[model samples]
Target: MAPVSNNVVGIDDDQRFALMKFRRSVRDVLKPEHNDHFLLRWLRARQWNPEAAEKMLRDSMKWREKWGVDTTLATWTPPSVLEQHFPSGSTGFDKEGSPLIIVPFVGLDVWGLLHSVTRTDIIRLVLVHLENYLTLARKQAQTHGPTALKVTVLFDLEGFSMRQYAWKPAAEMVFTMLQIYEANYPEILKICYIVNAPKVFSLAFNVIKKFMHEYTISKIRIYGSDSKKWQAQVLTMVDKDQLPQHYGGSMVDENGDPRCSSIVKPGGKVPKKYYARNMQNEAKKEYTKVTVKTGDKHCVDLLCADGDSVLRWEFGVEGHDIKFSIKRRDQDGNETVVHEPRKVSEGPPDVGVLSVSGPATYSVIFDNKNSFLRSKKVYYDVIISVPERDLNMSDEPEDLEAASAVAAS
Candidate 1:
């Protein structure tokens, strides 16, 4: 057979860069006699046909359009984004000098979901074969100082419900890996998470607060969205004292000797304001409840609140009429505030609604006086209110025919 063309295939730009570097590193080790066999074997292992390798290379040019695998160079930046969020200092570094290794703890289902949604081959690349490559990179970085060390993690949220997907494992994995990295590689400035979310950002703050006990690193920072509000909230909680005190040590009344009174004297009232503020803050913790009707006319009721403050109240209707409103009440149980109602024409059925049962009522409460002031309780009630029309479960032939026609063509 004739000599194979210099063209290569079955690789993305990042892969190609890695391949080129690999080729260069082994150039001296691979004598001319070994070059063709080694290269051919590597290509074959990747499922490239020896006879069709040239065709694949030529085809790769069109693959950019047909497969949407553009080889455009990615803009390179310092991995500071990861570092800023997950700073891995010099504690976990191996004696031989390698970047800390991070393994994600996401469920397989989440992995599959992300794979299907993203369809990025590099995702498969990392999931399947990046560990070995990362090890090599870490070794190289160690020998060359921080320039060679790199850290990265992957996240998938499939196992979690849509609501739970907001955070949990992703945030936990990123925070844990950062902690490990910081301990092992103090000189290494950053680490990276492959995906991002608001909850993950919040989790990072939680981790920072926890870390504060042992390390005095700067507060964790997040970019994008109303991050400042979240950061401020988290920091304020972290900085506040969360300890309870016994006030007005057992006092003696004028008539008694060593009287242990139930009430403390004047000094006891000093902490009352703080206690009330804490209680009010706890009462303000938010909760949600939902109600739905399924039939010719679909309607949904949502109730959400924090303490006496109603965060959300809305009734959504299907088809011609959809409306929602929210109201808040004061301590006296009177409606002190009302919000403008929003109305919109009905469109498609909400999958979120279909997945859940009807007439749901959700509530959340916080214990304002808890030493550790997190939301204390969350409650949910779902009531299904099926319409009378739905009880007569017979498909009309005309309706079925129309639906089939719409589905078919």
Candidate 2:
């Protein structure tokens, strides 16, 4: 293995050059705090391919802008349910000085959570915590060196149940979070220790692990309910002074409870009063209505003239089931299925958001061709949103020129 100019091991001359090239191409978007170590994470994720890394970084920046990661997240207040029941905390750092994040996995009441708040709010809550932990790691890196640039997580799977995840919404939320983490925050995990996993956990892990990136999968170490085995492993990486006594460590909360209740809120079932379903009708957005005749398909083409746009949709069929899918056609007339066709019912609108890099047309299709008896009426709200960019801060021209220069070289 060769070393890069930044003293990051395992990078040869080619990778170093690619890193430099990738850095220059995205210079306009780089924050004052971003360094070669940050760029290398993206490069390594894309197998040291500069162009691929650039695309990934640019797309992530667009997502951040749209989600207000830099602007609103700092001051955003989470719903009370989340503030009281969200189960995670950082009581210490790993041996290498990386921030240690502990998640009481069994405390995640996905069903109660989704009912209490919009799915968007749940995702935003996750983002707020992730950003906060990453910020901690960045700060620790100043004293602990690059080794502290990542986070070490301990997921206590005691009482973990697969029942909630059996529900489609819960499962979808898991995948959505995994996808978001892998794409936007690559290589941020120093390690992940999942302890107290029941034997049945293998079944769930087998399915969800498929959604994880190789880098992420490689860092996970799973253990059975044997406390001694897992405790010993944890103690090796985390000092007892920085960990809660409940996990074979010496630290305790101010009240002297071993579980560190002050830091890691033991999230329990959310009260029914907070259910968003009860208030759905109070404020509703209008939807466009259209009918797809029997043996015919209705398609709505949403043009994303600029790449890095987000396409969001909510729809439901009236009185029957309808097959819905999304496809993208690019400048060369190449078509690709963005979402596989799925049968959606009239119960709740099938809602989803897709991040697309496109100078392309996205077709939202409601197919009723298989239904020979009756036409299907679809109620849908679809929008293509571009991140609001500050014109004074815009760097499109310079980014384009840098990309051209890199390509030419």
Candidate 3:
């Protein structure tokens, strides 16, 4: 018999039998019950020609290598490399052309007593206000370009010793901001915190460093008091230089020698373990007692007095509120109706919005008329709600189920 050309061939009886056997073997290996029907069809469609089938299999393997096939598929495209599909100034833009704003609030004192509030609780409040601020910022930016506004929070540490709760609340706030920023706004340029003590700044910067490392954030700048310069520099150093080394681990040659040769051995600086231990010890110190004559007295005292007084007052009864809510536009075109209202008061100068995520309208309502209360106090209220049905996750069950099944397989 004449040899068949590579492009065109007639299947002889022997060839046909071999092809049938191959199909049977493939089918047996990939049981229909175990494999998807579409996958089976795909396999069968490529079985007619051996070269085409081999090419298809090689292509599929390459695809699997390129895209991955794990249960929870993760395709990591670096931010710098990824296509900027959306137009410039699309989402997450402030009026002043900043990407997004994350305001971290420790408490109301800036040096006052540590309130009897949990770090988690404070973070929740900050998140609520942040959402409202972002909603307002986004609308304002869209309508009137960008505007410059710093989201400030009073970190009172009076009655509470700085050693006790300084880093804890600050760390929590930074972590929460990181989570919200990662989930919603990847383009956030700056995060500002109106902090009191140098230690609190250090603690918050440590948390920020952690997130910066995890997310590969290259540039981070902090502006605070001179006392915090050391802490800020530490954060910048850890973030810009050390974190990558830690995560990547010591690179070793085939013989296991460290890849980078150093003339001077690195040691003698304040180690993280020791630093953490010291912070914990400081936190355990006894706080000075402060007289809270009225709700506003603590605030006034902290702001007016020296640094020592401010730190002491934070631990005292300085009223502060942290709230979380979605800002939504009502039918009448006004941003109102914040979901889940929570109030925490420690004197006046309300701790405004901390961080916001997702899409919604937010409004900062000041109690202009103190009709009910005789004292002239400023408190902030937030309104948050979803704008469209598409944004709601109620109808994603079927897709979720399919994905879950695929994942299990």
Candidate 4:
């Protein structure tokens, strides 16, 4: 027996509708290879709920637009900041053809690295890697039948501390990253092992896990870190030669040298020249203050008159975190969010900037929806600027004010 429908062979009505909506919204970015298998990954992540799955897919597409992520996939290079701070990489494939990516946190310069890059860059870097992972997964799936569009994450948490995960900004970033992963990337992580976790590392993760969805939380395993038990389980998944020597695995090549070229050893110094330029965006900035209590909200509306204009923002919090978004209202009095919801940050930390695709009222939302007992105090500022341009219509120019309006249509 077999299922049959206009939908993929396995998906139902709701899942099919979700896929249809995604194609309609971002048809330009779609490649022929983004077939049912890709759709199934998003469908399964939301447990086949059409509405939830559609929103996740939409948000992800909008995010891709603002970040120029689609173009990044083809031509983007990893920023040096990522290479210097984040000691993570894909080593090799497992028996099932799933890629294995390892992140060694022991003695890593997490604090220095966290401050070195803005939240957006961090997200961008992670997404780039994920995009790369998907590329490999798709190729492997062709050779080997049926595969989950996900990767195995091995988080080596040895010697992690308050200085690393305890920082409010860093913790918030991790939480936001988790939210993005669960809502958009969904089910993309095949499995995760928090190996070599020091007891204190639990303190930091306890707070971070609160933001993770139940489905994702279920896939995580905190095993015997830095012990025989950890190595045993890791070896079962990855060959010893695929691992680094310091972790009791072999990286030695046939000539008695390092064999694995993909592995990245933990730790590196970001040169002084790049540090200041990297931190310049995050340096001292002014902010406006407002309070939003539970079920309450504070919104900042920035109006742009032309497409290609930029809306940039920066903010900080006093007591609790707030949800942030960029939204525009359609003619039917409906709101379509323009940027993926900000899952982390007091606000951009450095600056959150998006180039307007059309003239519209871009709303910056400070939602305290998750807070219960207290009001969140947020200090922020936004700048909307545009370059002058003529529509180049007729000998006489049309009103410049019509720039954004014309673009919106």
Q: Quick one: best lDDT, which candidate?
A: 2
C-alpha lDDT of all candidate models, in order: 0.30, 0.82, 0.32, 0.63
Local lDDT at 103 for model 3: 22
C-alpha-based local distance difference test score of model 4: 0.63
Better of 2 and 3 by lDDT: 2
The TM-scores, one per candidate, come to 0.22, 0.67, 0.25, 0.58
Candidate 2 overall Cα lDDT vs. reference? 0.82
Write the residue-wise lDDT of candidate 4 on 1-409 in tens digits: 1111123466667767776775565556545775656666666777765566567777777766655667754575656767666667766766567788877766355456555655556666777878788778767766654453467778877655544443335545665667666666766676788887765455445445655777678878897554687777777867776666645477753444352323554655555555533544554545687878887988888766665654556667775477877798644567788766765455334344455645568788888888788788788777665422311111111222256479889
Candidate 3's TM-score: 0.25
Give candidate 1's whole-model lDDT: 0.30
For candidate 3, write residues 1-409 as lDDT tens digits: 1111222134566655545544554553342222222132233345445445434444443433332322223332322111111011111332243333312122133211113223333333334435455445444444343332222122222222233223334433434545544433332333332323343344334424534433224344344445344334434322322211211223333344331113111111222322211223344434343332222322111111111111111222233333323334433566554334434355432222222332323343222122233333332222222112112221112334468789999
lDDT of 1 at 272: 22
**C-alpha lDDT of residue 16 in model 2:** 88
Ranking by lDDT: 2, 4, 3, 1
1-409: candidate 1 lDDT, tens digit per residue: 2222335555666655545554564455343332332344343333434334334333333432332223221221222222122211211223233342322222223322222222122222222223343445445553444334443221212122233222223223333434433332222223332222333334334423442322223322333334344334323322212100111112233444231121111111111222211222223323243322322222233343222211212122333433333333344445522324444334422111111121233321111232232222212322222222212221122334468789999
- Indicate the residue-level lDDT of 201 in model 2: 75
Structure candidate 4, residue pairs in collision: 196-225, 196-226, 288-380
Worst 10 residues of 2 by lDDT: 389-398
Candidate 4 residue 99 Cα shift, in angstroms, is 0.8
lDDT of 2 at 381: 80
Ordered from best to worst TM-score, the candidate numbers read 2, 4, 3, 1
